[model samples]
Target: MHYAFDADQETFRRELATFAQKVLAPHYQPDDRAGRMRPELPREMASMGLTGLRVPERFGGQEADAVTTGLAAEEVSRADINACYILLVAALNADILVGNASEEQLARWLPPIADGSALSALVLTEPEHGSDAANLSLRAQPDGAGWRLTGEKTSISMGMLADTGIVFARTGGSGARGVSAFYVDLHDDRISRTALDDHGGRAIGRASLHFDSVPVGRDELIGQEGAGFVSVMQGFDYSRAVIGLMCVGIAEAALDDALDYARTREAFGGPIGRNQGVAFPLVEQATRLAGARHICYEALWRKDQGLDHTVAANMAKWFAPKTAGEVVHQALLTFGHAGWGSDSPQGQRLRDVMAFEIADGTAQVAKLVVARHLLGRKFAP
Candidate 1:
């Protein structure tokens, strides 16, 4: 029944919004042109504790709850959706590590991320096996007392600049059981990176990472050998909802601009917003965005309360980005000509929001998860 943010949460959300507008919004369009994150971007966001939102205080982090983390995604993405990618990957990695890593492992691995000395990537996808991550071919050959990884991971967000990555590789027989997670130093000479020029989110430095005999000792093992898939997958249920919020944030920003245009721009000697044609589509999109936001927050809240949120999370994953894309497209149309320009956020917002529909699994895959949860596994797709 509670529909509003608590006093503290509201205050925090406002502070984040202000920071996003002042520090991140200015770079939103420009960074997309630069095709890489700025040197100070990591540390600046770290200073705000955004890069460490999910880490425990002992690790120099805020240990923020899932809802708080979702709020950060929503607020930050409104100004710069690409900047939110850093927080997204960081939160996912922190959650996975905290849930699975040994105490010693946590002690060593968590600090650098919390302190902004490290930027993290979840290395789960390969070119051949994306949604079917269980079938990934990246091999982690057993060495003396460790393993040597040799394979390629493409479509990696932050791969170009990440100092650390939790790479999942095949270690045993076929399928998911064969995979294990390794916390690897991406800066090592054994690893070579090819930066991807993405359609959007270029600021996050998406890339392909190739590992040729990269060493991973026993200490770098994240959890029990075969548990990596489950650990990482569990984190996704929550991160999906966070991504929904991020997608909604940019759409909301675009909507705001469209509304502004409708109010001031004259058409037929009157404000265009006065016409139902211009206003109704915006209204419909607004309603859809509102519903998506609620679902996203509900998923995050369920995770915070120790409830099974898979259904809500997947629903948000599929619904939010799709809704956002529609909303941004409608908003662009509202501008008529101004929105088509590269200078306008509408075009960039549309491109950026498009990625969420595909990243973290496509809408079709997310719907399939919800169907499986709603119907019995045998009865579902």
Candidate 2:
């Protein structure tokens, strides 16, 4: 029945909001201009425990719940949406590691991430297989007791900067069952990276990762071979909610800026806030953002409660980013000429938010998931 953050949660939210504005926001534009990730960004995030939101405390992590993880992502994203990709990918990988990794494996793998010595990327999408990830063509040839992965993964978030990644590859026959996941060392000389000339989210270091016979020890195999795709898919459901909140945060930031401008900027005789045409659209955007944000939080809440949240998460995945794109574009228009310039973060926000509509899961793919959930697997697409 309660519809607000508890006292501790509110405090945490405020702390993160301050940290983000003071530490992260300043670099948001600078990093974009440089077209690269700031080396210090991950270290600063780790100091705040943003990098370890889902990791176990015993392993030097905060061990935060899904709702809190989503909350952290939202607050951090308000200052820098591209930076939130680090949070999203790390959280998703952490959950996977926590659920499927053995104690020894956890000991070996997690502390570095918690302490921010290592950055993680999800090596799932391929040049030929994006949404069709089940049919990924990456080859994992058995070599001695381990495997050697060889293929290309394109449009990977943080691919260029990550010291390690969970690389999915085919180990058996064709289709999803043949696939296996490995938490491999990405820093190996066998792997070559090519950074994408991105239009948006430039700081995320999206790139194409080419694995050239990179060796993976048997110990690095995540869970059982052929079980990788299913495990990753399950972890991804919760991350969709996190991605939704990320969209909400950026759009909310844009709307606040536009509102401030509307109140202060004089037009004709007085403030533009006087005009219904200008005021109403902002009103509608705010309302839409609120609704989308609520669904996102609700999905994460369901996750924390151990309830099936696929439907809500998928819905949030589809709606929030799409709503954010519309909202940011509208907010940009509200800024008049000021929003059009390179100096304006509004345009950057628009481009960054557009990536969400395609990354993780595309809007169309998310709709299909919700459709299956609502219409029954037998009836749905």
Candidate 3:
């Protein structure tokens, strides 16, 4: 029943928070405005072994547990929300590769990511299949000695910049059983990436990938064929928890900023924070943020202990992002006219938090998962 973080975890959190504030924060505004990923951030994260926190030590990683990774994600994201995006992608890719990739594939892929020489992005969502990933129309056909994959994946984070992608395509027939996962190199002539614009989390560089008969060897298969859906779901289970942490970070930052402004900005010759109208909303926001944070950490802890946490993870993923959006919206309102300006960081925070509401899974989809788990399929129509 211990609720507090251990000394080592606390130390890790403090170190990450310090690094994020001192280094990452300064780069967030300019890089996000330009829709560019920070060139040095990935290398810096690699230097600290943050990119490979969940990877095996044999693969040149620290082999840290999931809770530590979640803590690091929260700290970095508190300074700059986009930092969470990078960290989560790395963690998710590492977890998936470690759990499913063959020994030779791991040898080829894991070290570069650990050393920051390579970046990996998960390519599951397509233009046509957002939540219906099991029925993705992307086809990967047997071609001579290997496979030729042709499909278009849209709204993928780090899609343009990633050295490799773990893509799910249909190799069999229809539905979940037919899906298979493949690790494809983006450098192939048949693969093309086009950067997408006009979105929140602009610093992360989402894109659309067009694969035209891209060649992949048999070793690229992750897990067994027809087992791809299960692998992808497992990846989501890991990733959504981190995404919940990201929401908590962003909400905390926004609320802190708004509170600071409320305490300082004079209204009617007194601080606006003195008024119950302004103060109560702030209090409510803080309460919601705290609740969401607890849920996120509990889910992470359950995951680290290898407990069945699908329900808790889904709950956090559903509630945290929506709560964050509401908190940021309230924060923006507290800033008045200043919040509406594009020049203000609050507006950017709002847009960034909004994306999370739909990122890993929509609030509705998450609730569906929770409902199904709680009620069971035989409950009712």
lDDT of 2 by residue, 17-103 (tens): 999999999998999998888888888999999889999999999999888898898999999998888888889999999999899
Which portions of model 1 show Cα errors greater than 4 Å? none
Q: Which pairs of residues collide in candidate 2? A: none
Using lDDT, give the best candidate's number.
Answer: 1
- In the range 53-157, model 3's lDDT, one tens digit per residue, is 887899998788888888888888778888667678878888888888888889888888788788888898999899877889889898886678988998898
Global fold similarity of model 1 (TM-score): 0.99
Candidate 3 to truth, TM: 0.97
Better of 1 and 3 by TM-score: 1
Instruction: For model 1, name the residue pairs that clash.
Output: none
TM-score of each candidate? 0.99, 0.98, 0.97
**Per-residue lDDT tens digits of candidate 1, residues 282-343?**
99999999999999999999998999999999999999999999999999999999889888
Task: Give the lowest summed-lDDT range of ten residues in model 1.
Answer: 372-381
CA lDDT for candidate 3: 0.85
lDDT of 1 at 151: 95
Model 2, C-alpha of 155: deviation from truth (Å)? 0.8
Window of ten residues with lowest summed lDDT in model 2:
372-381
